[model samples]
Target chain A: MRNTQVIQVEGLTKKFGDFVAVDHISFEVEKGEIFGFLGANGAGKTTAMRMLTGLSKPSSGKGKVAGFDVLKESERIKERIGYMSQKFSLYEDLTVKENIRFYGGIYGLSKNQIRTKTSQILEELQLSEVGAKPVRSLPLGWKQRLAFAVSMVHEPEIVFLDEPTGGVDPNVRRQFWEAIYQASELGRTIFVTTHYMDEAEYCDRISIMVSGMIKALDSPDNLKKQF
Target chain B: MRRLRFLIQKEFIQIFRNKALLPMMTLLPIIQLIILSNAASNEVKDVRIAVVDHDQSEISRALSNKIMANDRFSLLAAPFNKKEALDLMQLDEVDIVLEVPPDFEKQLYRGEAPQLQTLVNAINGQQATVGSGYLNGIIATLNKEIRRNEPLFFSGLPKHNEPVVVTSNNWYNPELDYPHFMAPGILAELTALLTIVLTAMNTVREREIGTIEQINVTPIKKWEFILGKLVPFLCLGLVLLTVGLIASKLIFDIPIRGNIGLIFAYAVVNLICVLGFGLLISNFAETQQQAIFVAFFFVLIFVLMCGLFTPIDSMPKWAQYATIPNPLAHFISVSRKVLLKGSGLADIKMEFVYTFILALLFNAAAVWSYKKQE
Candidate 1:
């Protein structure tokens, strides 16, 4: 189990010109685990996620994702992992299938792989009927699901979801979690950040961060008992 | 390389998918090239002249007739005095007032160099300069007629009166067809404007929409990313150049003396240079509005100094030196030389070298300033 660690952080810190966004923190996540990074507003969840996803550099600390140093080998880290931003970053003007093909292509996926997976993903998401429509025409829940599906089109080793379930109906959030659990079951690591305590309850393990430092790290039942 | 192709494909799709920007990009150059090119020329034509024929002599009439005979000037009125002529000029009714002094014919008969008073509205300094040149041309032609018509029998001077006629062949643009020169220059301008505005705004839009964050997380290299943004716009730029060339050839009758293939080749280098500069500005701008303002700031300065409207020779030494690295300046010089003058690559080797160097520097700056994060 120790050898199965997919992410390892030791004293990871980040600074933005005198503002400590992510203070010294340490954590680990094993393979095939749903690890929830819980934090309140301005708790540095996003800043931490940015550093882990290679979209930002950590300041004065050590961080690793998928056995690659966060600072030095960000390019390699990018190739091996997936990231779905909270902003719904997929192109709304592009059709659902086009958006899928675009992401898959950028990840160096072949035409055949893209074509075959396009139908598979659309069918699985029950979005086959609307796959040819522009993503802008879809409801927020559908767009959110489609964005997540596009992020994983390249079959990354680990998929980092930054507040993936933000601002969605409870039912949709539940459905989104089901997809996360399914990905975890397939031995793909999931590193998700969320503000919902209930979502944290569904994680295999949870680490609560406050003021750039981790205050708790345990399973849901253990944390509840300790609290 | 494969990832680069994909990124380029994504960019092309996004660009073509943009309903608002696509129409503007396609229409602006067409309208500006067709409408503005004709309006952007320096050749002085159709000057209204108010002639004050005080002498009312054959020589004064011959001079007025010569000014009118040359299709460049029109005599609106033959005023009795210079005051009415001056009034006409002040009212903007005439561009020049030609007052033939009373001794105009008598002075020539007496072998004295009589003064022909000429007043020109020098409001538009270039217009005034050209108008004055035309005035000098009329006077010189009359002087030649006087020299030839003067009888050698008077024995006023020696046989050295053989007229030293300065036959100026306005070569290349013999008729001084302002349109022929303006068409290609405007095309160069259209290319520069379209590529700059498109590349700058497109990159910044991605940042505004937060798509840049998603792209930054990709495994794509920085050079690949910048090239991805540039290649689509470059292809579109080529399309624009071709259309402009065709329009210039068909509508304006602009001669294509140089090799069309050579034109395309240099346009590639020129497009790369302009696009690279645009991308460099985009890399520094944090928002789409900022990108537009900054891009316009540089584009305005570069285009204005590129000799599109003003002659390069007329610019001061410092301004000419400043235009040395301006890619639009290089492109305009190359396009005009190639299209109008039939100049080959050998003739424009220096321009190509400068553009190539500018392309290298601008692309390098664009890549360097592009922060992969934040």
Candidate 2:
């Protein structure tokens, strides 16, 4: 599984009437790879990521995530991956512990499994004290971290994060990246999209998009010298 | 099924957490039932009358006394002539003018039918029409009495030439209690309003806040998500109906004449149809405002034609046919029939079957239109 590619897509594209959001982009992410998708706003990076995560259909191309076809087997793809959107996606009215348990339950975890994972997530994120408080009471930085943790509660083969640290400060972004690294070390492939160049520098490999097409795909260090 | 349970639990927690929602569910329906049933009534009462009695004979006095006998009419003034009575009506002091012509009893004594003129302020059409109908009933009764007692005036006629008497007995709601009639109809309306608006708003709110994007990436099935939404609001609508029923019984003394289970059965189908219609609206609307506007438009039409305040039979033929698809109208009819008329299942089977079909169709549309991925 380590040597195998978890995501394989060829000529994947998405169009909205007269506009092409994602155009014939081809890429493959190996197992345990922290693949960074970076581009300016409206450059189709998010659109491409949506296709991989089974949140949107590819217009006229074939793609597979975790060996499941994105077009036909999206439901199967959904069960094998976790997705965190650009917006904070947890229920703000629910307490931290309830949010975790809810995601765990929805992901097909047994009751005992959800209970154990709830405690484990609370302990790991150091959110045990605030677990009883509503997510609204927590600061912005804490909410984002909890969202990522909840997304990963089922321990999927891949976790797709779309600007998971959009509004947070530098220090919080560092801590959030640490969580991604920890998830990667646990053998979960992290397919993340971010606007921060510094965040792209941390990824094992990065793909830069320009006008709905990937312009460069390589190790960040090699791409830094090439640019 | 496990996923659906968690979704339902999460929805309930959110609904209760919103500060305005609990009162909207509990206190609002009770308040609406009490105020609407009491205020929105068709039975005209306390009509003010001014009598212009130029012929102050025994028969004229008896007619005036008989009009004032019932609690429906009260004497505002006994003016000297029709002009003074007209002046009272002009000042809005009296709603009606009862004119008694000169030689009123003499006309009866001579066996000549004399015309009795009455002027009514037609501004408030319901009050004018129903009030005049009441006056006509009283005058007819007095006319019958005179013919019976004064048989000597009709000596040339046969003994069997007496005027025929007609009596009316109101069925279902005897005494014509408007509140009793209104309570069940309003209950149906509130149930429909709550289920539709709440379901539509909550679904759009999820999309507006982007929780739906998170939900889309999950393994939860489409039917599971829909059931998650439908089940909680369905239960809430039922709870609302129960609260309204209890309140109507306590305040209006509305009798639950039929089997309680039959009412609930119709209510369950009605609510599910309403909720599905709401969800279908939500699918077309991208924002909470859009959902509410669309829901309000349909609800206004539904309530107006649902025969809650006005009888559906009175609506024009096309409008009456249009109300056939209105779930609120059907529910109101079924509710009134079962709750007030003591109607059994066989009596309301048509309404029940139509609503059940709408439930299936609307829910299918809601599911078909709700997309996990674009």
Candidate 3:
């Protein structure tokens, strides 16, 4: 895995009318790095992720994500990045394989590519038996794992997981981390947001946001030493 | 284009997996087409009535027979007095009353005109008018017979000349079968109703479920996303339209005089407008229920103002102006022109233009509402 800047943010600011959700924050994520974004509820981590993912416009400032201009080439950036929302954003009515195929297809994967990727994803998660079952029928742990896998189906250069393991068991979270590590090994940048302090340890680097501003950003051990 | 195919595939999978919505998407239009087509007829028939006969003479019996023979009147009871007849009318058991005077046939032979009275329930004025005309026709026939051989009496009767005659040339619907006229309009209405509800609900559902955010993050363009959601419902609308057409033909035997292709062409344009309205509603609504409610309310108003049930000329000028963009109005006119009047495209160019422009305006509004970033 190469260490190159895949995402660069400079004074990115987002305001919703009067309230500032992400206030003039700046950051950069190197390729194949597990960049953990830590924040409390409403600390603007989701808002910032939204801007980086092109889901929301930055009120001001500038950024480039995956070598695409954030302002002018947001559509281009969108095509190359994957997003897994905090809400376990798989279609509940669709089967696991269907969700994978749908996301892969939307990312411009051909049928053969989706079929092959789906099988590989199912094999990796040991969820081959439930691939044909509806996502709604699966347990929360399985859903989180499936959502993570579905987000990477198109081999996007970067994957954004918003609190991806919100309500899963510890064993499932450990397994989910293994999948993220595997994605990093495959040269894909992993930008994850989580409230779990323990999950921050798995990242290559971590940023803690407080009240729409980054209070600390460094390796976990370095942050603990500073504290 | 690839993203669009994927989005459409996702929608189809979701629709197929959601067992409840699938049946409703396909079946509701057909069921409504069948039921509303029957219930929406304008022909007034089987009106209930009561007869108060005090004469008990052959003339009174003859009048009663004529009334009974008419398909429009159904005699509920023979009331003995005026009070009893009024009581039946008040109870809603009878819609009309035929009152016979106590004078026997001797009055007529004595060269005195016996009086007959018809009391009608006028709450529904159109039905009352039709009932009155039917009763008057029967009385005129009876009067002609009463003076059949009395040239002296007829000559002295102030020359009862029936002048200032009016004729109705019911061009399209000579028989005036209500189902035949209503079926086509109802089918057109189904296109509007189903297309709006399905497209609106589908888009709002995506927003609520957060799949829209996922898709937005993909390389998919805005047009791709919109078209992905739209094309499936358009196909569904066409399928429903075909089913409605089959129902009209097989069950009601409604005629198809003009080109079937032209009807479908108009339907496609009309679906674009309906779906555009749905997309606009989805963009404004925050929840699925809100989207459904708003769409339903607007569709109700559009249908009422479409001139399907009432004459557009009778509506106020302001109300007529409000219906200018209503696709149903144009579709209804086009439908009747084609199905009943056997009119070609040349005959309905204005209607076609109205529908086409309305479709374009709605689509432009929808595209404008779909924001790329929020």
Off by over 4 Å in 3: A1-4, A67-69, A110-116, A127-134, B50-65, B75-88, B97-119, B147-149, B157-160, B164-171
Best by DockQ: 2
Q: Which has the higher TM-score value, candidate number 1 or candidate number 3?
A: 1
Please report how far candidate 1 places residue B217 from its true position, in Å. 1.2
Tens-digit per-residue lDDT, A57-159, candidate 1: 8887887899999989988999999899988898888889989888888888999999998998999899999988988999998888888888888898899
User: TM-score, chain B only, every model?
Assistant: 0.93, 0.93, 0.89
lDDT of 2 by residue, A130-194 (tens): 99999999999999999999999898999999999899999999999999999999999999998
Q: Lowest summed lDDT over 10 consecutive residues: which window, candidate 2 chain A?
A: A1-10
Model 2 stretches with alpha carbons more than 4 Å out: A1-3, B52-58, B77-94, B101-103, B157-161
DockQ of 3: 0.72
Most TM-score-accurate candidate:
2
Candidate ordering by TM-score (highest first):
2, 1, 3
Give model 3 RMSD, 1 decimal.
3.3
Pairs in clash, predicted candidate 1: none
TM-score of every candidate's chain A: 0.98, 0.98, 0.96
| Candidate ordering by lDDT (highest first) | 2, 1, 3
RMSD in Å for all candidates: 2.5, 2.4, 3.3
CAPRI level of candidate 2 = high
